[model samples]
Target: MPSIDLTINTDLARRILTGFIRSEIGRIGLKRAVVGLSGGVDSALSCFLAAEALGPENVLAVRMPYRTSSRESLEHAQMVIDATGVRSLTADITEMVEPYFARFPEMDKRRRGNMMARARMMVLYDQSAAFGGLVVGTSNKTEILLGYSTLYGDSAYAINPIGDLYKTQVWQLSEAVGVPEVIIKKAPTADLWAGQTDEQELGFSYREADRLLYLLVDRRYTPQECVAEGFNEAFVQAVVRRMRRNHFKRLMPPIAKLSNRTIGYDFLYLRDWGT
Candidate 1:
């Protein structure tokens, strides 16, 4: 496969993302941010950036773990909290989700995982309200493009500073911003289940997926073009098809066009109310 340079100027990206967090939060008339720290690089980086942008006192990192969650997950999350000195709270999600899980005994791991994810999101939003802050998002572009996230769950956010960065870039930026080396090196997982790792679940490594996604989506290469560039034809086709199938996850729910001023169709100006 043709090599793609995913290397980024970490200093520059860090500056831009920190500024983005500050500006986005400021524009909403809020000075604080609440982040769900999953002990993964993505959330760790988001928490770090948020703390830098809004001061440690202004950023709250919430770790929501289920019964089967790893001890390392909590330890890793605490590492970020300690390293950044951000206020944090740990909310165990096992109880919150177990009732539903018990109600549907037949629900498989995927369904259970989704419930855990949404349960964590609920905790973050509740903390957002209690802490008087906006919810900062941690999902990266690669995951978003592949629809790896659960809608209204890990995918929901008031503002996302790292959403445009690919998963490869997320690691680069994380290392640049002093995210724990262990976190940067750990297998990427949501910790929703005992042995659930992201790449394993997706059936492809982030490195492979990110490279192909960069070519196909960022570079607008067709599947045939990607194959010509040395990507496996089947792999290219699969990634492209998945991206097409998940396009809706990247967009707002379609509003049926009825009046001249539809909410999403015509009323699209974010600053129409004069921010």
Candidate 2:
């Protein structure tokens, strides 16, 4: 609504991709990057960037699929590994998760989804330590803004190269970087719940949502201003409300200020480790 051109320069995009990887490496001293490849565009982009940043020898991709995961997903994941020449592992997590779901059959789908996300993170972190690598997050800015990711799950990461881009932008970058067509064209799904699509769950198209978010967040457009520019008032309000409400998830946990400079209170850093 606040006027998005949605145009990307192919040359500039290539530069941005390299720049993000370099910036992350400089900030975190990345030796390697570990990623959970769900056969999705975001993960594909992250893996591609990791391979580019630290070389394929330093990138490890793990595929953790539950019982309901699609076979095509695995195939697509294999394609990414082959294309990027990165080493990969397939750890079917059905055995790990089924037992918990059996105990709590009535667990909300969202809760189960969160568990799945967190389980993958746990596995990725362990792999990171075992291999002396960092966990690269796959979430984009649009999902982060909409609170669409699970806390400590897909949300937690050692480094995130694509966190600043929107959902639609993810596809563009994925294609530019030579991600598989199957993943790029497929419906965006967390693959947590069966038959669940991201657009369907969000109740809005990525184009519409990205536009409104750009206005409200990027352009600093007020709610009334967004509505006047042709965005639905209710939709704009919903997005802004969600962004404000979930601000905590995007930040380090709050620390009590008993001392002069409590951790995460007064001290802030662009580096991951404090020296």
Candidate 3:
């Protein structure tokens, strides 16, 4: 099997990401951050970075779990909280999403999963306001590029320190930051449903996907070139198609260009223009 080395300088990445979290939060005049900790390596790494950037006391790790979420998820999340000394809250999202789930008894797992994800975001934003902090994002480069995240759900964040890192890189940094061993070793999942693992849902392992994405995006290889680089043709085309199809999820909602100074177009500037 063709393999690629995606190893990163964990120490350098740690310093840069921690500095990014601090500066970005401070830029907005906030000294604290709230992260949705899912007991996955991604969120665990994000929480560790947030704690390092802002003191543990200033970082709030919220564990929003559905009723069917694994007990191990809660346990692993707590492990991060215990390890980081960050303030923690466990908000069950089962009730928040059950009303809608009950309304549509026939709703498939995909619709239900999206609802659960959005519900978790709602909890995070609410906690962000209550905790006086911004939402630190946990979605990594691999997931973002493949459109593996839900719009306005896991994808929403004030600032994302790890969005640029691939899943493999997340593991590297997670280990450097002392994320629990179990989290680093476990199969990746969003825990939206009982048995739904990320690889199973996507039909590919993150290792393979990361290599293909690195070649296609970072190395600027075309689909044909990627296939030539030893990736299967079908895998390359599927990933390319998904990336193109979900391009809208990576962007802000388009505003109709009705005026000379539209919000997203002509009048593009920081919200704190004079501050």
Superposed model 3: Cα runs more than 4 Å off? 1-4
TM-score of 3: 0.96
lDDT of 3: 0.93
Per-residue CA lDDT of model 3 for 1-275, tens digit only, reads: 34567999999999999999998889878999999999999999999999999999999999998889999999999999999999999999988899999999999998998899899999999999999999999999999999999999999999999999999999989999999899999999999889879999899899999999988888788889888877899998989999999999998899888877898888868855654
TM-scores for every candidate against the unseen true structure? 0.97, 0.93, 0.96
Error of 2 at 274 (Å): 7.3
Provide the overall lDDT of each model, using Cα atoms, as 2-decimal numbers: 0.90, 0.85, 0.93
Among the numbered candidates, top lDDT falls to 3
Clashing pairs in 3: none
lDDT of 1 by residue, 200-258 (tens): 88888999999998988777777888888888877877787888898888899998888
By lDDT: ranked, best first: 3, 1, 2
Mind giving the per-residue lDDT tens digits that candidate 2 earns over 132-236? 788888999899999888999999997788888888888888888899888999999888877889999888888888888887778888888988998887888
What candidate 2 gets wrong by more than 4 Å, as runs, is: 26-30, 272-275
